[model samples]
Target: MAEKKEQPDASKDEPEQIVDPWRVVTTSEKGVDYDKLIRQFGSERIDDAMLKRFEEVTGHKPHRFLRRGIFFSHRELKNILDLYEAKKPFFLYTGRGPSSSSMHVGHLIPFIFTKWLQDVFDVPLVVQMTDDEKFLWRELETPDVARNLAYENAKDIISCGFHRDKTFIFSNIDYISSCAAFYKNMLKVEKLVTFNQVRGIFGFNESDAIGKISFPAIQATPSFSNSFPEIFGEAADVPCLIPCAIDQDPYFRMTRDVAPKLNYLKPALIHSTFFPALQGAQTKMSASDKTSSIFLTDTQEEIKNKINRYAYSGGGSTEAEHREKGGDCDVDISYQYLTFFLEDDDRLAKIKEEYSSGRMMTGELKRELVVVLQSLIGDIQEKRRAVTDDIRRHFMTPRKLNHKA
Candidate 1:
């Protein structure tokens, strides 16, 4: 079960997905669709052969989805990985501008990817819950929306298997007040960035708040270790590497620009493509639209129903036509989702073959994606149930850094 495809910019009214590809893609007639990616992203696109070279450069296989074009864009990812190989530890930072209650399954992408990086590198992690940001852009009340959503967001993020000893979660409301170093970093950034700079990078308006205008600095603070001096032992020199969805790159670009003046190491980053809505890749899925995404709280029946009713399919209208023409896995919703969640390379390969050649009907393919995602979310929900406000408070509090040196 999958939803029918809609116009590319369907989520135009949605907050985050309003802008089209921040960049572009390139397409060649002979091999690979470079044009679609450049058209979607911008003039810059990461092609398959380029990805193979990146893997060879790093000596790690590109994550399958990266290989599959689900994550078709990047900026300075190789540099970040190279730094890691040189034994330079870069802490991880990523954020959520909590705009809703219960997060949808798609929201977990960065957290899950980041958790892997943390374990692989064994470094400290700081997750920014940008509730203040939600208030700045949307009509939501600042205190009520931020405090409430921070609590709810902590639950969803904790469900992603982060280590309690190593992970720190902070809402802008809570952390900004407690950390002097954070504010200092914020001021340094504010000093370097002008209203003109933000306007050019983020398309911000002059009517926006000194708070909203200054908000990027709050997002930038965690990239410095001293933002949590208590946690990083007041180590201002240590740098962080952020792994985020590419839409978020503008903030860190500003951060990196000011790092030299601040005498801090510029943060390295690994950015991802936007996770397409259940409707399609042209727009991001919105929590406001029930049919646009699958929530973590969705029951098995709800999941099955959502997939059947809303997940977009590339399968042809008629079964005979589908068999004759074969499925286009390029925008195939089932295959697309599987690329994110399916870790088993062999089974994924089989599914791709069956799907693209039309050996498997869209319903059957959707069922596979449903099963894979249901298991993932079911496991996450069990962990989420164990998190309490007390645990959240402990994690949120600034504590002494457990420094090995």
Candidate 2:
């Protein structure tokens, strides 16, 4: 879920951008400067050559997210591709910190892309729901609240169409107790990572709880193949690829740094940009804020009302003025959302052209997005409704995933 951090003055030419696990904040209408972020994070850009290489190796077109540079930055992705090319085994790891009962549309980006990746690569995937992290961070009534939220969020993730045989979703609170290999890896990470190191990586201070200080190890454990003996057997050397939002890079950065010392393969990563809120690109959508985004549970009328009422418009004040001056798709929330959801490339391009040229009004552009989202969310709702407790349990169960490793 999105939270904004208080920052220095926005009047400056460059507002101080703050992106971390808990918050994503920027004052720019065009959102965070991802190129600057790529440099700051020391991650490589997913350039044209890389895309070409990916297509060549996988024999599948790069996902729309990759093609559009939505998942824009990466670390050691080529290593994973090379492993795939050589017919060696690798898996996927991604996670959610379950803070809310229902996840907003922004929460689906990684899972959607991960599903595509799973289909393309034919590999196993593990989704970690960090209920323990949420319990430490959030002011929930009890640990059970966070635990329940994890289960709820898993249904939404499962609704993204991950194959049951290829996907295993687990809650941190639940799995750490049951899996000895996972706990061993967590202990290994905790031992290698000092208090000073964690402070440097995660900005943990002496005032923070011991739980908060040590939680990075829990998140890092899934990156190692030996953590799940049922899935990968005793082969602790099998590397894994993590598909996650760039905000999560810090946890994995620490994991990667410690991998060699543990004699384990470093996890590879593919990073996605934050999905901007309906209110504007200046901040990400908050699951706690009903008006900030479209929730998976929102009705058709709510979707329409939210977009029409709250979606930040880049058009002129009046219809006549809009027609003359044109809308700015670059800053338009509706147009930005379409870039994520609308699948038809030609149609999206056409919409972009017409809207930016003043030929299309803000309402018209939003109407197009509303239809696309309603249908998309409608389909997801249908799928989510069919995801029973039993189905979710199967996805969460510790079993051998159906993949050649």
Candidate 3:
């Protein structure tokens, strides 16, 4: 019999047991069935027919390839599409609570999809970096850490090709200082929203600070374009829409409930499902947990090493077993991640077929993912490198935005 051929260890730096995918499987788990998750996430699946219908209905080719299931879940998206078709103006609002120096790959999903939406609709995009929220949560030195982190996060976002003329990026700490109009709107939101409502909406205990109760208002302020009157001017007549994950719905839900009473446009919403961490969907990724995600700053060599070492696989023991039995690609972390990055529709379909039917080995699947992701992240890192302090300051400066409107 031929000697059992051992593959070269892609994991050259680590110890033997650390690279095991089964390490994540402490007890045997019948992993997350994604089809069931689609229903649970409250977004309709976009099949090929739906994609064709979406284009016919909108009269524009989608800015994104909906084929890969990136924008998987949506609520009230078609209604908003109708509004866009009518040439009605609606601003895009989405935010991130800056808690760390660098965000993980999980962090980029919304921004990537949001960039596509901006290109598709040609609408204004307002990105809020919630430094205040981070200050309240972490034991940071007052607001400095949050501010610094927000600046870092903003650079990563600016790398996403957002049009500076149409996009306004704000850090709560910095923007709050000069934009008294923004705060005036925030105060209105604060008064209308009750402590009980916040407790119910955010799961805030009574022990939380007055600041904690107030932060939601800061988030809500952007939903109204007039908060930045310099940008929106008296055109408070223009309604707004927010595109963020469903976990954030409560803030907007509270806003929607209060907008009518306040006589503001009850901000329209488009909610997406939570981006699953590399480990799984049950919990969001933590920057504190280094192993839970692949970050943009990771090196090409590091990307390959990490996937080989940490990315979960669904292939069998022997190549013979893989060819005969086929691999289970449904829950494999590597294949699922590839769906997000790989752009070629036909190549992805073929890969899916081969992997699902066990024709392609897990190593092969991971190898393909590694190359594509390496290029994507490498390109991002290059753009990020070119973003100098001068460029960032221009983007971060509140006054630079065309507030004359």
Better of 1 and 2 by lDDT: 2
| Cα lDDT tens digits for candidate 1, 274-299 | 66678766567787898988898888
Compare the candidates by TM-score and give the number of the best one: 2
What C-alpha lDDT values do all the predictions have? 0.74, 0.91, 0.71
Task: Please identify model 3 stretches exceeding 4 Å from their true place.
Answer: 1-54, 63-65, 317-320, 399-405
Q: Compute the lDDT of residue 358 as modeled in candidate 2.
A: 93
Q: Scored by Cα lDDT, where does model 2 land?
A: 0.91
Going through the candidates in order, what is the number of backbone clashes in each?
17, 0, 4
Cα deviation at 1, candidate 2, in Å, is: 33
Query: Candidate 3, residues 291-354: lDDT per residue as tens digits?
Result: 7788877888888888888776677778888888887766577877876777777887899899
Give candidate 2 regions above 4 Å deviation: 1-13
* Model number with the top lDDT: 2
Given candidate 1, what's the lDDT at residue 207? 79
